[model samples]
Target: MKAGFSAFERYKMKGRFKWIAAAAAVILCVGLLFACKKDKGKEQEDISESTEAQAQAQASGEEGESEPARAEEEDPNKLEDGMMRSYLSGLPVDEKIGNRRPVAIMLNNLEAAQPMSGISKADVVYEYVVEGGITRLMGLFENYDDLDKIGSVRSCREYFVYTALEFDAIYMHFGQAAYAVDLLAQDYVDNLNGLGEAGDTCFYRTTDRQAPHNVYTSASGIEAGIKKLGYREDHYDGYKGKFKFCDLNEVVTNEGGGSAKHIEPDYKINKPWFDYNEKTGKYDRYQYGAPQIDELTGEQLSYDNIILQYNKWAQLDQKDYLAFDCHSGGIIQYCTKGMFTIGTWRRDVDSAKDGNVDMAPVRYYDMDGNEIEINNGKTFVCVIQDSALEDIVLE
Candidate 1:
């Protein structure tokens, strides 16, 4: 009876040990599965963080690369209000000139007026044939407020009126030709004619020179004339600018471009040539075998830009008077610093305006149909007869 009881106790202890082993196996399997899931979750989290960091780095790099390029594309000389660039020279100024008018003074380039007064102060100077074979000059001045005198004023030509109107300028002349008189009388054209009723107030005679060559005007006189005429002080609503300009910081050497070290445009009257000075990066002006000096500055006249424009011309009536087709498109050569390129120029005529021809603006373009860019400084415009283009010499 004691042996059988001991056998039963042993059997019960073995059964208990079997159940304990099964429970330990189940716990080990659950721990292995949980470790795998935790490891996969950590791996996924690491991948997501790496992708986010890469995306942020790429975005930052792109912005950093584009900023400088964008700045270079836009005009570097752009400024805020109260400061503006001169339309003729591309230089900065304090006044907003869009509203103000330029003064276009007709100057005699005859032997008597060889060393003209106040010419160096002009922002732009236009030379073209008048009556006979002689050439006359029309000076466009923007900053002549303090100039004591402007010219030995000359008579106006019909073509010169068109040039003055391009800038919406206040035209000043000692007299007018028969063709120009009718055009100047138009309400759209604002002029200060020395021979007209306003002559006494707008011009004065200097004893330093003779009759017609002695007539001169000053900035104060011009201001008084503007007040008397009641002309608009600001630009017209739809008025646009004339030329495209290089940035102030940019230096246009025109490398690999055609050279323009010396340029001569034949006017037949005053044989003029411009010699480029490498040191000054400017062209010293010469006319009639001598350096043309302005009596006001006592320095030889110089220019940063020179435009030789070829236009269609005809002899008006039987007289020596000539007429230029100012509205027509024609060839032009642009010279800046010491380089040049061929281009074209046309007047932007708005047919909608009808008889108001003064509203049109002169536009310039390169051979590629893009606007020709000019250097920052004063400009000299020579209107050569189209048939006489062969007379121009350049090296």
Candidate 2:
């Protein structure tokens, strides 16, 4: 009976060993399947990473890539060789810029003409002494195509004509000084004379003001005058712009230049001054202890740049009318971005076929002889006589 029990125990042990071996085989098979699944997932992740890298290379125009680069296309706001910039505002111009010439309108700046219309739209404004210790303004406009009215238009001076020609603008004036008459008669000089027989169509009188102050011109009248006079509409070939303007991202405050946080151009009558505003980044203008406002927009007229050009001048006649040394070099002050710079300006004079003097390009240079770079915005030029330059104040 003891021998039989020992054999039975040995049989039970064998059966248990067989069961443990089968369980171990099943565990090994499950581990192999998990390893295979992990390897397949890693292979798919590698392919996705490789595809993403190829796409990034194609976007950035990397070498050895067959796809076209996305970043190399031309910008719509940029023109061919920087032609998209407005000559007056120095800002981007999507319209036909050099395709059409600017219009320089002679505007009266007397106390009676305060709050004048259309000056706010001017891209550049010039204030200079005329007669009786007063100043006149020449507004150079690139986008005056849609304005309803421009000015209580005034007469043209010879120096002002030269200034207008520097921009190749259509000179618009109600009358002219004797000094300007010859220059205006030259074939190269395309002007709209408001005193001409065509004055009836180009200018009108408003009962609100007196005789001279009542005279006004509109955009339609100026356009009609240009067509009637048969003047060239587009800029002349080979016409480079007058200024070397900096990009919008650039701040060209001339280093070592004097500070111009406050500026005063001493015209005896208006007593005009400019104050730099930090918020607007513009120099707000003041005259006669009041803010100078534009009648059209009813907003204070302001400018981004101010230039004080000191030139030699003398009385052209007994009438106290003046003449400026427009062709010669002179002292210049370029004020922009709350800073002022000292420079010089000169223009080349070309002789017309009829032997009359025609204006060439006007250039400004720093003390180092490099062309002065202006900020991209509107400008106001004060043509101060050398004798009166001492009266200019800069703070």
lDDT (CA) for every model shown? 0.75, 0.73
lDDT of candidate 2 over 1-395, digit per residue (tens):
01111211333445521211222232123222110000112233445777788777766877464654458845434655635778777787754754589989899999898779899988889887987788999998878777887788999887788778788888889998765666777667788888885587778888888878988888888878888878888887766678877764555654455567789998888999999888888889989889999898899877888888877665544567665666656778788766676667776444222233345657777655777777778788888877766567878
Tell me model 2's lDDT, rounded to 2 decimals: 0.73
Least well predicted 10-residue stretch by lDDT in candidate 2:
32-41
| Model 1, span 166-200: residue lDDT tens | 88788999888876766777777789888876788
Question: TM-score: which candidate is best?
Answer: 1
Clashes (candidate 1)? 2
Which residue pairs in candidate 1 have backbone atoms (N, alpha carbon, C) closer than 3 angstroms, thus clashing? 99-234, 99-235
Q: What is the C-alpha RMSD of each candidate to the true structure, in Å?
A: 34.1, 33.8
Stretches of model 2 off by over 4 angstroms after superposition: 1-83, 348-357
True-vs-predicted CA distance for residue 305, candidate 2, Å:
0.9
